[model samples]
Target: MHIELKYGNRKLQGEIPFDAQLLQPCIPPPAENPALQVHRALDRPLAVAPFEQIFSAGERVVIVTSDITRYTGSEIYLPILVERLNACGIADTDISILIALGIHRPQTEAEHRKILGPLFGRIKVFDHACDDPAQLVELGETSAGIPVAVNRRVVETDRVIVTGTVGFHYFAGFGGGRKGLVPGVAARKTCMASHFSVFNKAPQTGKHPQATAGVLDDNPVHHNLLEAARMVRCDLLINTVLSPQKEILGVYAGELEAAHLAACEQVQDLYQPRTERVDLAIISSGGEPKDINLIQAQKALDYGCRAVREGGTIVLLAACRDGFGHEHFYPWFDYQDLAQFEAALRENYQINGQTAHSLLSKARRFRVIMVSEFDAEITARMGMEKARDLQQAIDMAHANLSSMPKTLVIPDGGLVLPHQFVKVKTFADPA
Candidate 1:
């Protein structure tokens, strides 16, 4: 079968077995008018008062949103949100937009323009400086002892609205919701502390099993983030669910936790696909910014590997144009031993280190052949084999399998989660 997968800004074509199962999220058609959906969602919010009613006139309001890395349909929603606030007697001067950069770098002027769309220049926009102590306000700690320092602008605002797109996160269950607060505008230490929950309590125990994707119940990472987010004074949340093509499918607005939960359920129903385990899985880290760096691209690897059996072969297409998302990320690979890596991570916890650990762990379980911008040596250092292209990677994977293997091809690995279907026998079923 001829298959085309996204590789950075371009597409790579390859041939797979015709019988291979093509996995993709069961996305509904894009909304005809996404802007209208945004308006309607704000008009009738879930579990909270209307957007206008929640805020009084002349109040200082801040809309916290994801940076350029994770597009939240902000261009479509921010203007409507500003218009609503304006109608509520809030002047443009009293309102500001804070980009939840977290530990990421500040957005460039072009990037900011893209994120804010029409609201650019008209409304003041500031990037959250996670490392700047002067910009952060400590708001106590979570039950799990994670410090809850957030951007002073968000904490001091009269009304805070968190906005982002909802998607299946590799860990912390799902993204969006309180994530816009905890790691989004949180301090460097707060972001690290909240993310450190992904690891087990014991040193050599590895990552907490419950910290896997598409889960929320008892997920230590999610719990830590939730606790930290609740420490802030967030008045509303407006999260969107996008189609695989990045069109708005649904807009969820209202109370923080409740609204985000509603969006998470929709993401589960749309993005999680069920299939039997396959011997070979070919996956792509969707395109452009999704494959912008190894840090972000690893999410597709985490989610796509679920469809492959242990010791199976995986052909991962991650452009990684920006290289390791962070400078500290690649160095973690120096500890080739998982146990040693865990110990090092425990000694000085870093979010990038955790991601590197996760990447190395997957490489150990599966023969990962990556088609990316990284050099062969870099790929080898990370425990992955580098291929010049998708076809070469496919040939390498096929050569490793002893026989003609069952295969699964996932075009949008970053957005889709594949689950193995468990066979159950009932009394009425044939034995």
Candidate 2:
């Protein structure tokens, strides 16, 4: 059968053997009227007061939003949020946008305009400078001994309204509400400190237990992040759940935790699909921007890791036009040994370093093949075989496998949590 998977900016066609299974999430159709849904969410918010009730006239409001890497329906929702604020008597001039960079590099002007769309020049738009001490406001330390410092704009603002899409985050349980406060606007030290708590030398044993995706109760990372959000007073949280195509599926608004939890449930109901393990998994990071770099594309690879059988091969289709996508990530790939990688990460501990560590952790179990625009030499150094295209990737997979291989193809790999729905039958279950 012929299948066209997502490439950088376009689609790449490939052939899957007739016997191979083509697996994808059973995603529902997009919300019929996204704009109307946004308005309805605002009017009937979850646990907090409405937007109009929260903000008064002549107040400085900081609208914290996710950066370009996250596929938050910010372009569609930000304008609506601004309009809601406008109706609440807050002028456009008084409202500002702070792009949450965490430890990621600052976004370019083109990206800023692209992400915000209609509201780019209309309001004051600023990037959260995580490294700059002058821009951060210290808000004391969490019980876990991590210093909490966030962007001063969010902290000082009379009302901090957060807008972003919710999805299953690998570490922080879920993304959207509290995340926009912690790593979104947090200082570099704070982000590093909180992130460091989740790393363990033995990933297979699940030593990083609290860091699992879709888990909120007793999750240390989420707890610390929510503590920071409370410190900054996350007054209004508007988080959207997206379909595999990045279309709005559901919008949850109002109180920080409640609204975000509701959105996370919606995501789980939409993204989780039951599947058996496959010997070969052909996965894509859902095209351009998601595949723009190795760092962002690694998440989809992780999803593949969860779905593929042990010792099986993963053929990852990511454009990776921006190369490794992080300054610290490529260096760690040089260390062939896990101990060496972990030691270096513990010593230096950069954000990208963590992602590299994760990649290495997965490499321990499964073989990964790359089909991207990245140079072959670069991916080879990272212990991944580079294929010119999808045909080459499939051929390489066939060569690596000892027996007939069953296949699973995830077109939108990053959207679904494959790990959650894998069937694990106990001895007591009926055969």
Candidate 3:
């Protein structure tokens, strides 16, 4: 099969050999991190599963995952998820699936199979369906002027399991909680409403975690998510934190509040992206899967850019393992020499401008360097100063570097996803 792959504003054609085997998910398998050993070390301290938790003695169980799950692969919490439920005595037959689509297109059966992998015929796999735009049901409005509505399928399920990785989210305090319900199952009005506040554009202090954490309680968007999860009687939440290799380093399962908190702690251990001030920041998705989609790809530039000095540069390291997911993002990705991508935002067609306006907004002060296994010509047009290798990106940064007087690097930018509650660094700085 011949398929076209695209990055920002660039496309390539490739032929998958007729006999080529499809890729399979292989969890890197983590051992343990002592500082993060609370769950295991304290396993004895955890309460036994409640006999009548959620579904009761005889009822159905349904599992739903975050919309962030990708096609290349994700450590789909299937085993850990199922085993947890089974330990509580729930049968597999009573469990099904729901891939939260959010505002994105519904998962094709093929994509579902990948997300479902072995889940094909064994489990009654399903995806969140709200194709008829009118079907979204409103639960209520939040104090933030955001309306809250949810997919009826998730709402009406006998007992629902919410699953997602716990990482620092741009708006919400963490990614696993109410977000899955908002954009995942909640009506667009509620999703748009909660987001209608001044959250997304809030200034991010390059080195301070406290600045971000302080805003959480006042965040209208976050409050909306908590309110909705309660309204639906969300049974249990299962959240994960992946290692640098994307292994499930930690799993938080149980009560809604506790589960999320546990996952956040794990997230803080690995992904606390803090840098006082740097002459240059070298960042990237650390290659495939994480770098596969631009939606997920921009994170690297976002963090690295903030930590950099004025007129400093961010050299992004990405093989873009899969390339950009949304086709519309490709055309807007040119103009390499400039420190900005303004035309798209100021132009007539902002539809194509969404990605640029966003990147430019995030990348205001610093220049960007893109070194990847991607086509050179296209990346050049996308406003990224192209480089051939990791060292070269650094060399380029070093050559023109400015006053900040230091460099902070994240070898796996995407894997370093942070959670606000993870707490700030202290002992590391003896100064």
- Model 1 score (lDDT): 0.89
TM of each candidate vs. truth: 0.96, 0.93, 0.71
* Candidate number of the best TM-score: 1
Q: Which residue segments of model 1 deviate by more than 4 Å?
A: 422-431
lDDT per residue, candidate 3, 66-140, as tens digits?
Answer: 543432123345654565556667788887777776655566676666666666667776666544455566676
Q: Model 2 RMSD to the real structure? A: 4.1
Better of 1 and 2 by lDDT: 1
The whole-model lDDT of each prediction reads: 0.89, 0.81, 0.55
lDDT of 2 by residue, 294-316 (tens): 88888888766777878888999
Residue 277 C-alpha lDDT in model 1 = 86
The reply for model 2, stretches above 4 Å from the true place, is 200-207, 419-431
Full candidate order by lDDT, most accurate first: 1, 2, 3
Candidate 1 displacement at residue 39 in angstroms? 1.0
> Among all windows of ten consecutive residues in candidate 2, which has the lowest summed lDDT?
422-431
The stretch of ten residues in a row with the least summed lDDT in candidate 3 is: 16-25
Q: Which regions of candidate 3 are displaced past 4 Å?
A: 1-52, 67-76, 83-93, 108-114, 129-131, 199-215, 273-276, 321-323, 327-356, 372-383, 388-399, 402-405, 417-431
User: Which candidate would rank higher by TM-score, 1 or 3?
Assistant: 1
